[model samples]
Target chain A: MSAADDEIAPLPSGLEEARSAFVALCGGVGGAKLASGLQHHLQDRLSLIVNVGDDFDHLGLRICPDIDTVLYTLSSLNDQFRGWGRARETWNFMHALGQFGGDTWFQLGDLDLALHVVRTHRLGSGETLSAITADIAASLSIPARIIPATDDRLRTKVVTPGQTLDFQRYFVEQQCRPRVEALRFEGADRATVSTGAESSFADDTLAGIVICPSNPYLSVDPILAIPRLRQLLRDRSVPAVAVSPIIGGKAIKGPTTKIMQELGVACTAASIAKHYEGLVDGLIIDEADAEEAEGTSLPTLVTKTLMVDPRSRNELASRTLEFIQRLGGARRIGPQ
Target chain B: MSAADDEIAPLPSGLEEARSAFVALCGGVGGAKLASGLQHHLQDRLSLIVNVGDDFDHLGLRICPDIDTVLYTLSSLNDQFRGWGRARETWNFMHALGQFGGDTWFQLGDLDLALHVVRTHRLGSGETLSAITADIAASLSIPARIIPATDDRLRTKVVTPGQTLDFQRYFVEQQCRPRVEALRFEGADRATVSTGAESSFADDTLAGIVICPSNPYLSVDPILAIPRLRQLLRDRSVPAVAVSPIIGGKAIKGPTTKIMQELGVACTAASIAKHYEGLVDGLIIDEADAEEAEGTSLPTLVTKTLMVDPRSRNELASRTLEFIQRLGGARRIGPQ
Candidate 1:
């Protein structure tokens, strides 16, 4: 109803039998919520293309925050109250690290340190991040496929007022205090799109692709910055939709709106739609931003997109899938 | 009473005030026990030259078992029951690592892992092992210095039936299951002795050096393997003595007896004394091996060398210092 376009097509019938598999593009926390929700409804049929842009080495341990968040979310091991890291986590490692004068701003939990140690060891032994992630997911008994955007180095560097900082340093260490001048995805130009991620789009029974409610520039854009991934999404034939991270001129979490404002862009769902302009067939906005959605020409789904709990997450995921099926079954919807 | 040499020189005047500093060559556990005893009496006057032969990277963690044991023992944080790692330790990290199918054979406690993480990170940042160890020791407020034998990769390799296994693999992972074979310190010929370790011997107030009751072939010899260290000990004017690791024709701990037997050497204090024939001026024997002292040409001290308690350790340490003083201050004791 928020869409300005009057010629919007209705959803196709038989969604249960026709659609069997789909991919979800996700960041940590917020996106992981939707990804977890999708996994809840789609079960093993879901593939999460997790952002590895925030990956960095801390104290010689390879930390992939976004991938871990998604994995923890899907496996139901993530702390719902804390909104990060493993549930029932201990801080003995962090306490000890602090005693040794080590940098403690990142806050690596004791239980979570095991994954990093294993990952750093395996990566040092020449195992691909994709392979290790897949193996870890399987070990956790997570049926859904969790894939990184790339096994290669494609770090997201945030250029602030005076200096550029690594994604984790900017976000976790500095607490995003620095005013962002710009964002750059290092190594993204030459980095290869993960095979699993690319093939997810080529699946014959692919229902659609859902860009989870993650920061457009910070999380999702880095994955899209890879030329191969960018080109594939541009030329793909499947219906793709994005759930807006911004709600009521403010981000639900993190510095999404602050970054958006710093970048000289309006912090609104209309801007989010414009940010994904040609890539997505539809945009899902929160009920709070329904009135502002009329400014965009893209088809829109107005609902309570702030996925506060499992029920809300599932409801949002179901609605997004229904919207994707409505545009066209396993086919891209042309721009109005 | 144990020494046959009646010409053994008496202590120099101002013995307590003049002789303020000394060094102790130590390995883990038993050596640390004696080192702790020495520390109890000497306070800040002791410097522990710990063996680095057992140090190895497990799961990318630069694990220095001997140095850690000495540090933990001295700091009173060592788990007396387990004879390793920090007290009040948790195994959440190890359990998680096991869940991920990682190498969990080498136990890394949650609290202990912080040390490895910090060490590995600093090492990766190009900080020398000695500098890091010093920093860690300072942070822990340990009065006595705990110096590794070398900063270089001087690993102890065990030559088994047809293959060479790294020290930790031969010891911890394999639990010393491999049949006795020759032991070699890889990189020993090229490795430079740690500066602090070398300087500890050169102290002007250097009362003497005590070779703690560690394995002769497996532990003590590795420190002696470095040509420079061996030469330093040989040319030193200070009195040097070794407390026997073997008592009652058997090693008190570890695989000393097994390894000695495999090397075709008798597991006796006499064989142990012969092992350090020229390096040590005197040998301290346990009451059980008091009769074996007659077989050695060197001056000997017979006492309860099994430092089972703090009181016993303090007594043994006081006796060793008194014996060193009696050998004539600032002059090497010639062979009897």
Candidate 2:
């Protein structure tokens, strides 16, 4: 599609009714896509509570992979081909860093380095990640709120067949080469849900919670691992739903299916429903996986969730909103 | 002069001289110019022992302004117009930092951020600034050794008319507008000279110490303030000579004269000589200030110290070497 054509596209009609407040638990690329789609449909009604376990300090800058991906994708600044970072990026800084024998496993572009630099500066100056993310997203003119799951430092570690590796090492550097044995969130036990997450839970206008199609073991679990987070979600009266990341026994992107298979679980929508068993009241599976959704105890809806183009994204977002409304939830779209 | 013509200029005779070891005490811009000239003239023989009192953490990156300037200048990569940082630089990172409400007075360039990133990473990994500098300089094809005077944190504070401010605050943010009352090196008394400095002092074939024409108050004093540094220079049999940063009651660059006046000094070449009276065995003054040479206690040599062009730089470097030889010092030239 031409750039100009994409810019002036009209909003989907489903978004007109998606006025209810939402808190989404998200990962990086896969999750970012869904989060972006939801923001397009619901705008300010969406609040993305991103995973901080994927955060790592590389080249002395704190990189929140999932958080930045979500922020960039929502702001329409993300590089489409790369799935992360900004479009039209330059690597002059990375080339120079390589000359100095610095860590180059995780590539950082010149424009993207500005994000890390600003975030690192704010973190050092004693600002919480939540506050910093809000300020940064606002500067980019992103209408939806983006926040970390918690303010405290939480690292996701994967126990592979050979060794325990940090999230980035396993996901980016190693490219998910090792077979998964287990997973754990290092600081989740002590991490408190950020005030934004807390307020989202307390808000009477909240319609439902949407768990984006992020990696179950590596992404969503970290948010759920926070001691009181799951209990808080359970206490809320609003409907909570999750979209299955796996379709036709394969993940749309990343290592969701790989990790699930390594862990000896059936990689399907049924498995996703079972994984989020107590947390979510509904499940959304792609139409391709409709036959596999019959056995799930929770109410399930089928839609085309591929999101290959803007039309598909808007369509899936509209379908999801309609499903939420069928569950007795009313959307509260924000001011134009 | 055309850039091409500047490159075809003849090398000085002293450029072929080999020496076992050479040491220089340097500051920011003014000192960096002489150090660059020395590096050009002496190449591998030069060892720069830079003062770290001006070093500070800005935006979480350790910024050693003098050391970076000297390194960039010696590598022929310095931004001549800016007087510091790398040439052909971009301000994207600094602009982003300003957008995030960060302290933006320092003007860190995009390419310059790479150095800070690498240095900060290495330092955090337990590498000393000396080792990191060596790595960076070596990568840039710079043959000289660059060492920080001390590894411990030492800060230069200017006691202005009203309050004492950090070196960057006084020099950069406030544009050096504050009247100086006194200047002090905060951690100098407790800082031990780095191993690089001590080894240069103990080298059997050590030549004369060159005090580059950096500001005496802000640039060179911190190096001298380190415990036993002055005594080591005084006890050495080799001639320790200083080049005057001021001529005709004005500094060649920076606030050397203003600072001297604020402290009630005459701001003359003789005053510069007297400032380093016991530390220096000889003083090199500009031909314009030849009238004041007879009044100084130390043996003085008058030469063209202005390094407006490569020829002037080479001439001053050759004359300084000739003066060292005529002072009856040991002949320490040629390949080690």
Candidate 3:
């Protein structure tokens, strides 16, 4: 059990009564899937600290893609077919924008444009991203607390062999084709963690922390790059675990594996576990990567991690929570 | 015939070659209708100086309603049924905006939003509204030069019995329900006419100027409120005529007659003509207001000024041009 639980009373035996609340750190899409599952499993007890490194200003609108994904996913408005944006989304905005000779590389769907417009207005009016996100999530009737890692500016830049490009320029405009040499989170060095996120992390009732299956180099690291935020995660008093974004030496979506390969890192669950070395107590891997777990010294849980449907998402969430409970009860153990 | 035509060569006997180029100052909707007719009739010879007083920063978007109307109407993309915005527009943005608890009072259509997005971005990047408007009109393949009255800020404000309100607040939000007492064009005193509009006005090839059938106080006055703009119109060498916004003691649309009555003026074509006594060389009135014309001192053109369709719009435009040509040849004349 967590140190706080041990101090309070005997640890609850059942999964549902393990702890009162937890925090989940994640990026867009893949992370949103697990965030959705976590919300279903924990309801209002889950607080999502979404990566804002992917946030960018386009056409004067501040677009927070990761926050929107988590919001759409948790609110059940996410398009399962396209795996992004709201369901029944229209592309007429981008279509018309194209007619006006606007940049259509990063498509802004009609319904999706609304969020960006409102968010931009709010941000321009002195509302912090954290407050705006909370307001939006609440308006969407999402029970979970969706918080940005920080409210201050912290944009990700992908450093390629030839030049440095903004996250979206590299990801969307160039289709992630550039050979990545390194990555930088501008403004993160002096940035402070969002008040809501800081409070949520320090909450005495926090059960565990889940570093969702998001890209470590791009998504997760930006949040980690913030000094205080990284410090909090590194010195967590509860059992913290991570779900591997990589499975069978390839990502389920996006360019995670390619980035890892470009960084000259081994494409294995053990390698991912090593990357998270001291921060996470254990790593959850797909059954496809179960063989690779033998080489890791950290505790690991092997399961069907490809959450293609709601059922799979729920099942994986349950398995992840149960694993956290086991690790909480018996400190960090050797690899299974 | 226009004096410029006499200088170059004998004026052609037909409506097509009566004058080379003319300037049209207008607002939204009603003004746009006649502007459309003028564009079809004059082709590249028509330069529209649309009123920017109605322009406002709404939710971080620089919305120029009159400019958009002129653009959409000229391109035949205007929604004839709805009387505003682009044809076949979608409300997915507003729908999602409402879901996000954003202000849905000002409805932004999916297709119409493209202009605002691009305009806002360009404005943020220090591009003048005039330059951006020209670029947009050119991209839309509109032959006529569409220009804002001035690039500097000039917002309309309405004074009610209770308090003052911004133009959009009085016009759109209040539905023009407030009892108007006075009106002001904020920042107009310091505003300068846009370069293209100024050049078009001073062009030696100028035929005449058509002050469109838009609300005199709300639309036309804002353009006139600018000191230099008004001075230029007053001292113009060519015929300058205005089509009466009021017909049969009532405005064809909006609150022109209501505002007139509220401001202690008679709701008649005579009152409208008198309003521009020292400004316009002549006035065009609907045949229904023939009696009201007898009271005006300026040269008056009696015609079916109610342009309910394209046929009527084009017919009125042809008649207006013919009248301007006659006045251009003979100079200002007594009422007939």
TM-score for each predicted model, relative to the true structure: 0.93, 0.90, 0.94
Stretches > 4 Å off in candidate 3: A1-15, A332-336, B1-19, B332-336
True contacts kept of each: 0.81, 0.57, 0.92
Ranking by lDDT: 3, 1, 2
RMSD of 3: 5.6
Which ten-residue region of model 3 chain B has the weakest summed lDDT? B1-10
Better of 1 and 3 by lDDT: 3
- After superposition on all C-alphas, the RMSD of every candidate to the true structure, in Å, is 5.9, 4.7, 5.6
Task: Please write out the lDDT profile of model 3 over residues A115-221, one tens digit for every residue.
Answer: 99999999999999999999999999999999999999999999998899999999999999999999999999989999988999888888789999999889999
- Global CA lDDT of candidate 3, please? 0.88
**Model 3 interface Cα RMSD in Å:** 0.5
Worst ten in a row by lDDT for model 3 chain A = A1-10
What is the per-residue lDDT of model 1 for residues B197-308, given as tens digits with 9 covering 90 to 100?
8999889988788999988777887898999999888987788999999778888778888888889998888898888988888999999999998998788999888766
Report the lDDT tens digits of candidate 3 across residue range B182-276: 99999999999999889998887788999999999999999999998899898898889999987787999899888988999999888888888
How far is A3's C-alpha from truth in model 3 (Å)? 37
Please give, for every candidate in the order listed, the TM-score of chain B alone compared with the true chain B.
Answer: 0.93, 0.92, 0.94
RMSD of 2: 4.7
DockQ of 3: 0.83
Q: What lDDT does candidate 1 reach at residue A326?
A: 76
